[model samples]
Target chain A: MGAVIYDRVALIGLGLIAGSMGLRMRADGLAGEVVGHARTARTREVALQRGLVDRVCDTAAEAVEGADLVVLCVPVGAMDAVAREIAPHLASGATVSDVGSVKRDVITAVGPHLPDGVHFVPAHPIAGTEHSGPESGFPELFEGRWCLLTPLSDGPEVERLARLWNALGSHVDVMEPDHHDLVLAVTSHAPHLIAYTMVGVADDLRRVTDSEVIKYSAAGFRDFTRIAASDPVMWRDVFLNNKDATLEILGRFTEELFALQRAIRTGDGKMLEDYFTRTRAIRRGILDAGQDVDVPDFGRAVLRKGTAG
Target chain B: MGAVIYDRVALIGLGLIAGSMGLRMRADGLAGEVVGHARTARTREVALQRGLVDRVCDTAAEAVEGADLVVLCVPVGAMDAVAREIAPHLASGATVSDVGSVKRDVITAVGPHLPDGVHFVPAHPIAGTEHSGPESGFPELFEGRWCLLTPLSDGPEVERLARLWNALGSHVDVMEPDHHDLVLAVTSHAPHLIAYTMVGVADDLRRVTDSEVIKYSAAGFRDFTRIAASDPVMWRDVFLNNKDATLEILGRFTEELFALQRAIRTGDGKMLEDYFTRTRAIRRGILDAGQDVDVPDFGRAVLRKGTAG
Candidate 1:
């Protein structure tokens, strides 16, 4: 086993991210003790029953007491309230971080409530599945994934937090909070909102029944449904928090979509083909960077017996 | 082996769908002979080399000369030209079908060019990968997928075509041409165009570099890239041919997106949450129908060794 990076690590929200972190840390002996707290008693019980933490606390303040590292894994809208609850109980020299998707809003929501001696380092792990809650996490969720840390100060505390994440099988990169928010807006928030919008549109269509959409989803709509099934409360908070950047990207997307729609109306195949070809190059770049597997259909066909070629 | 459904099957345009059909037919001995043709010599050579066809003909007319079953697997835009080329060479009492995504336009474009003795049964297999070309096909590609056949007449010819698709491991359903186009516009055509548009917008963002997007794609944009990377020519033809339905759905999508955008701007979390919750139910319905696998992230983590939980 590896060396323990922190003596006591407190997870403020026992959801997918925190549960995964606890599992990884415990499996690798990366922390001396992993304690967790959730807003609901049922979640706390599940976190304990599932071995996601050594002990479950009923209150956020009780969870953070005497901990050297504290990570907030709540939805973005709840971050401020959790921070306010846990601020008085945090130990001196404790490094506080978060796994929120938006960095700037998280920093704004969480930074003010911390104590003077605590080091506040905001982080966002760029890894997840559509499943949520404490039971949906696995130890390898962050393996080979990128964990972005937007630090307020570059100190030993920040380095220590980065080392902990690295030991959990994630590659850590530090970015400015504003730049990180904007980047995630382009890459994650906008795409998720677009998927949700498209799926909602399909569901709302009177001409096409839900049964027909579900039966023939393999055509292309299946991908959007997978993305749209992500945690609704979390996504709602993400959009509310990262409003500016998401709005900006969506504006550009609508403009580009309108141009393609016009091309279709005018039967301008060349323009549509050219635009599609350029976007294809971006997919090539993503595959080459090892961000996604190169398997066709994300290897879904191979998962079923007798379907692999 | 299964009994031969057709004495000879001719595939005009040796691409993913046609090549897959040839492989399945050959593997199951469902067709006595499978001959293919492509507009380019390279594709014809590859089709023969990959054993996707027993014989490779240079021209569409030569391929369909004595075949009892002729399947046009070309882009929607090229169906008219291919139909015109093979209309005079079609054997008497032969059945002509297609695997085009847009049914109404394919019916309109190829219906007039067929000989009076020929039977035109337009079929669409609601299955594909982002990959294309003859080399990218497999025998199991159509297994457990849906194939919709829109026939001009309910005759023995249509039943024969349906049986052929069933033998190839697909469930066949017959629908009207106009309804098929509108259903596909909601399920396939509009989602594809939206994915392409979002990927294009990300590619055009000046503030975010390509490398950043690629490195951080696991958050959500990876799914969009996979959908956007589909064959440009095929998608171009799909949009051009199904313009009315596609445009109508896109208009509805834009209106919904604007409403969500307004909610985000006004911090109406309840509206956003309600909409997201409703869309999540559709995903649940799709999962229950067995149309998509229920594993997290489409079982992508399982595909990589040492990453599965």
Candidate 2:
């Protein structure tokens, strides 16, 4: 148990991020009270049923009222409307933050709508599963994950929020909004779009039946499916909001793909081998950094057996 | 334990597939003796030390001597030379098979080298981890995985090999060589190429530091790195040997990617959302088929914790 960082923390959207935050905060006594609101009534009901929040409010405006810290956890595209809805209701001196993947677009969308006294700290916790919804969240969802904060201004509020994230088992790093978007573009947005595209291509291939793709997916395609299965609306908003950076990365990806494809066509084994060998080093770096599990097959075979009778 | 399927099984190349096959066969008493041969002395030493083989032969010819089943587990490009080297040494009634990823190429490369009485059954077990080498294998590696056989002729040898795969814990399927190549191109080869290309692009980007990419990979890019981390020589050979089919799939993938990119550029939220929604069904299909574990984040979070303490 940790000391309460905020007397009241309101989460504007009851999806995975909000649900996880509520659960972690409540579990560790990081906040005195956790309030949550969702556009859909069912989400709110589930959020309450799952103990993701101490109180479920009917509206975003109602959720933010009297809250010491307000978090906007909706899709990037919905940030502006939620910001507008909560701005007038936010308590004076309250620190406002977000769990949006793209920072620049979120800042552009939510900054102007905030009241002068309210602190807006745009943040992206670089952690989540393909699963979404309130029920999909767990208290340990953000454990050992990186929480990137792109603050408009540094103050006690930002430090307090960082403390909350730290208590929730995240390492906090501050980055500029533009750099955050570009970094996420390379790490998350572009990879997701490419995965979605490849999975879509596999599904659309008439010769390869869906069952075959599903059955033989363990041969590398399954990884893409897991990634492509992430919340569609959230990913769509990310791509749209971070359009330029995502496209730029994709363009480079295509150019590289063409070069590799040409090597395959021309039977240039050396070039293909060299390129592949280079990428292996990066995977090693990620594992050494503890960003991923070092277990073979991501330990899926073990997981499968563990779930079996 | 199951009855011995073969009097003696010889595994050439002694890499991931061969090592796993050796381990399973020995563990289950499926083969009377599991002998292995690797191109490198270090791999042979590791195979012996790891108990991946009962005996590590210095040369392919010595390993295949008197073996009832000789499995070519080498890279696609090395299939021809290995086949030629072992052709004269193969027993008169021995069954010769392979664990190659691309079927048609293996069939083309290995077909003519076999003796008249030798049974040529080219098999591809669609199972692996990103980790390779002799030490990476486990007895349970093939549990519930699919092993596709592209045989040149139908006989008792083919049925016996299928039974061996089934005993090793894989569902056996038979398909034409060309069709198998195309299906794998869509499911494995092309996806791997795409993952490799994306990782290469991320590494090449001057704006995103390698450290930032590694730290933030859990957002999505880490999955691609796992795929990209696969054995370079094997993947390079896969691309080279399955050129036509892989290139065709890559072409389709690029077209689909461009359409999605345009949607992002033009703010076609509906199209983006719809496409993403459709891809989600494939993931569901994979889970429903039991090809992938339904656990969130592939249960990586749990695995990480398990390893920690």
Candidate 3:
């Protein structure tokens, strides 16, 4: 266990990200006490039963009462409501952060609701699985993963939150809120939407049938299914909250897709080959950044349950 | 190792599939002696040095001379040429099969080239890594993977070839050529094209620099990079040869994507949530079918360089 970073930390949601944070914090003794609140009583029961948190509170307000660190782990769409609910109860010098994919929206939603003394630091951990809920979290989900922090003001609280994420086994980087949204639109948001659309298209295709698509998924569609299987409410909120950036990326994607479609229609092998080669270099860069390994089949077998570190 | 399935097997192109097949066949004693041929002498040398084959032949005809089974493992666009090259050398009663993603194209390209006495069974193994070439093969690549065999005439030769694949640790199924093309368009071909297009779009985006996309790829774009990093020549051949099926699936994908885009533009949260929920079920079916695992992160770690079996 590492040195304690917070006296008491409250997570406003008991889903995958929050549950994982609680588990990792407890595992490493990053926080003296880890408290959490979920909207549903069933999730709270599961959190307590699964040892995801030291204690489960009845409401977001009660959960943040004396917590020095309060992380809003609710869906992006619900950030403002949850922030307002817990604002009056925030500790005197507490730091309020989040684990949302889109940063700009979170800033706009949760910023005004937070009290003046409470520090607001918007953060996005570039780590997750398709699974959600209290039972779907593991301690090492953030290890070797990037957690981006986009702070409104460069304050000591931001550094403290960075240290906490470091203690949680993440490499943290500070970025501007708008830049974070645009980068995520290119990296996470748009790719996820595309995956969902492709899977939906496969479902709607009568000629292929659903069973055949599932049966032959190992070919390539299986990867898309994994991404598409992520929490529905969470993704819905992400798309709704990050509308402008997501739409911009999607627009670029559609244009490129059309160009490639034209090339395919005209049987232009050269264009296809050139485009594929340039994109291959991007994978190499990701590997070089240590974000992933060099294995060909995506190193899939090692990151599964019971095997992950 | 099991009993030998073929006394002598000849592999036409020493790429990923052929190399994996040769290694798996030898590891399981599925074939007595595996002979291989590649377009380049360097690949032929790598094939023998890496022990992917027992012997390396300079030409395709020389490789197929006395073999009981000759498997064409070249790209889809080159199948016709390779089949013609080895046609005269195919032994009497020998079965010639292929490992192409598109089956209808393979049948049209290689069917008439085979002599009357020789059997032609087109097959595609629904398994691969982004890495290609002779040195990339491994013995366990085909274990628990599906191998589809599309035979022109359902003869004993088809059964024998199926037994060979079975011994190589693959579950074999017979599918019609056109149906195979359609299924692949939905499962493999279309998904690959989509991934490539997404990666291409990211590369073309001026707002998000290439390095940022690579550094933050742990989001979802990394998955597309893996798919896009596949051999350019092979993908070029796949798109060109499977034009009709791929274009059809692409049209369907575009329609679905436009609907989702409209929903996002209109701020229809319910539509997004319901669509995501439906796509989530497809993933469950794939996991239930044992085509993939329930492991959330795609089990990526186990297949890394120093960690895999």
Model 2 lDDT per residue over B17-123, tens place? 99999998988999999999999999999999999999999999999999999999998989999999999999999999999998887888999989898999999
lDDT of 1 by residue, A1-309 (tens): 789999999999998999999999999899999999999999999999999999989899999999999999999999999999999999998999999989898999999999899999999989999989989988888888899999987899989988998998889999988888888898899999998999999888744464787888865798888889999999999999999999999999999999999999999999999999999998888877777776655666777662333
lDDT of 3 by residue, B1-309 (tens): 888888999999999999999988887788889999999999999999999999999999999999999999999999999998888888999989999988998899999989989998889999998899888887767767799999978789999999988888789988888888988898999999999999888887734464788888855788898888999999999999899999999998988999999999999999999999999998888877777766656555334335532
Per-residue lDDT tens digits for candidate 2, residues A116-177, read: 88898888999999989888988888888899999988799999999999998899999999
For residues A1-309, write the lDDT of model 3, one tens digit per residue. 799999999999999999999999999999999999999999999999988899999999999999999999989999999998999889899999999988998999999988778888889999999999989988878877889999988988999999999988889999999988998899899999999999998888745364788877765688899899999999999999999999998998988899999999999999999999998988888878887767646544334224432
Give the top-scoring candidate (DockQ): 2
Off by over 4 Å in 1: A206-210, A306-309, B206-210, B306-309
lDDT of 1 at A277: 96
Q: Which candidate number has the best TM-score?
A: 2
Per-residue error for A250 in candidate 2, Å, reads 1.0
The whole-model lDDT of each prediction reads 0.90, 0.90, 0.88
